[model samples]
Target: MPETSLPVFIAPPLRLPVRTIGRRTFDFSRQVAVMAVVNRTPDSFFDQGRTFALDAAVQAAVDAAEAGADWVDIGGVPFAPGPELSAADELDRVLPVVQALAAVSDVVISVDTFRPEVAAAVIEAGAGVVNDTTGLHDPRLADVVADSGATLVVTHSLAAPRRPHPRPHYDDVAREVADLLARRVDVALAHGVREDQIIVDPGHDLNKTTVHTLELTRRLGEVTALGHPVLAAVSNKDFVGESLDRAKPDRLAGSLAAAVASVFLGARIVRMHDARAAVDAARMVEAILGWRRPVHAVHNVS
Candidate 1:
């Protein structure tokens, strides 16, 4: 096998102080976090609304938490190019799930949205994090997060909500992504969001081609160098499918590989559809890298 070229620029050691999200606090530096995806939308790229019903969505969140996911990201709208969803409709879709999960689960709750109204509603409903995939397209989203004392995940996406960016071009995909995330972090900070309450995602496949996403993964340390916890949402994305020449249902291996690679490159959190597999992969990686202690070391320890 050919040797891969990883980033040579050494970032400072990951030093993510504990961040409070609602009643939960996470110290991201010690181990990788697996964030399970729970989409309540009928048109989500993967799962295709299997969890769209309120009962199913709530059950999915509970299952993810029980499967060892540290976080559950519930989304009302799909990020793909599609008809826009009104804030009211989005709220109607996600609020019940968030409320249910928050009431019963100690697992951190994140609402994936870009609208300030939706963010505010979910935060009020006990969501600990507001995941803005629009890259802060609406600045007021940050305001809502700040006011509610919720964590904010600012992703780097150039397109407007539910809009497509055709033929996207970037001089340096990783650098540009890092820069955009930095700017978004600044925006969040200026909006009164605490620095520790921020997480950054490079938005793999969000306005990026397969090659772009691969390059971003290759150099994800640049984004992690920004001093905030990096969230890699590499689960069953189109880029992984395109890279491995596999369909969405068949991309589990590719997604897990990409997710592990992201963690190796310094991503502190991984968002994934298969929570159990992802949690195992993350724990294995952390253990191999000496960041996590083995749950029980036995046979070879003699």
Candidate 2:
């Protein structure tokens, strides 16, 4: 009789899950969705107030949708350590943009905030996802998302929103991140958020050293194994900048490489700063992987 043995390698997901946001339903198994980043904060790390104005943010979102973005993640506050922003102030920044975009387009709108008040308000304003980068630090935010039936992006981070988590440490970066995300997902479920309405993010560069973020990226398959759609927000992240010794503006190639790697490893969604480029990269990756068909496949076919 042959002895039974444990598997040496884990297989990639045969198909990614599907999630509906706003008026659109994305089949991640057949598509790598592109989520454009539109920061409404003046201190945005990458844009630095480029879309801080309400008009600018609205226009950026519309352009991203036109450029093939499946979703627009509008953030009212920078994830980096910063002074606290009041809920009212955050509302003032993102609500109008959400309302504006909802009126004009069906592009899935997601708001990057962790405050319960802000989460509830935005969901009411037509936002479909609550991108909480704080790892459910305030569990009440989960309650808000649950009540609204909005998709909650459960992210991993060691500190409160806008607070510094200097010298963060992890035993196994990927495993730890997966564990954190899984726990947060459970917390969301316990608070009444459904399983299908949940997404997971490893939170690259959020309270993590470049080395930590790199290891997490290489081992991203573990996070995807959690059975929820994984979102990789690798656009212009410090990890890419530091790894290739490139400045923020020069990290485009590295960012696309990271995003592609994440998709290959089973990420169902990619959140990017460069919408058109990211959309192209994602489609190319999907075509190469046989998940998407070429626009013109007439080279050999008569």
Candidate 3:
């Protein structure tokens, strides 16, 4: 096999600190954080609303926390082939879940919504993180985050000229994504969001073909150069399905592999469906590379 070109930017040892869940700060030197996905929607791409009821969703969140997730991301809207919910509708669906999770678990709760109103509602409900998949299109979103004092994640999705279903048209995928994230970071900054409160996501599978997704994963280090923590959300995405020659539900193994690769490449945060598996893989890889702490000698107590 031909050798791949070296990535332009690899994630440096420097890890910028950020707050999550109301004043709880995280530093990357701690280890990779696994953000478990909790889709409350009945039409989500994977598992498709397996937890439709409030009780079920709450249990799911709790399970994720018990399973070693650093955070539980709750989303009410589905991203698959379905009609988009209006801002009010989205808020109505998501707020309850966020509130429920916050009520039960201290695990950081991230609300995934592009609507600023929805974001505000969830933040008010005690969500610790705001994950904007539209790359901060809603101007009020940054304000909501600032008011809530929560960390924000900005992700990339190409416009009409270069969307995934229609084949993304990018001059250079990695640099273009990096530039887009930089612009979104500027937007967040303009709205009074602190530099340390920001994280950047490359929006894997958002508007990219299989090749584009792979290229993004391979060159993730370049995108991390934007100078904020990088979050990788490639779990059970269609691109993984294509890469593995399987359906979305059957792509868990491939997703886990990609998640590990993302961490190896420089992703500080990995948004995933199977949190425990991903965490185990990351820990094992870290051990192999001697990234984990050395155990100290202990006296025998027999």
Write down the TM-score of every candidate.
0.94, 0.94, 0.88
> Model 3 TM-score?
0.88
List residue ranges in candidate 1 displaced over 4 A: 1-12
Worst 10-residue lDDT window, candidate 3: 1-10
Better of 2 and 3 by TM-score: 2
- As for lDDT, the candidate ahead, 1 or 2, is 2
Q: Mind giving the per-residue lDDT tens digits that candidate 2 earns over 183-260?
A: 888999999988888889999999899999999988988898888888999999999999999998999999999998
Off by over 4 Å in 3: 1-15, 18-23, 159-165, 289-291, 294-302
Looking at model 2, the pairs that clash are none
For model 3, the local distance difference test gives 0.79
Against the true structure, whose lDDT is highest? Answer: 2
Model 1 over residues 1-302: C-alpha lDDT tens digits?
Answer: 23334343322255555676667677665568899999999999999889999999999999999999999999999989998788899999999999999889889999999999988888888888999999999999988988888899999999899988999999999999999899988999999988878888999999999999999999888888888888999999999898888988999899999998888788888999999999999889867666667788797879
* Cα displacement (Å) at residue 195, model 3: 0.5
What is model 2's C-alpha RMSD? 4.5
lDDT (CA) for every model shown? 0.88, 0.89, 0.79
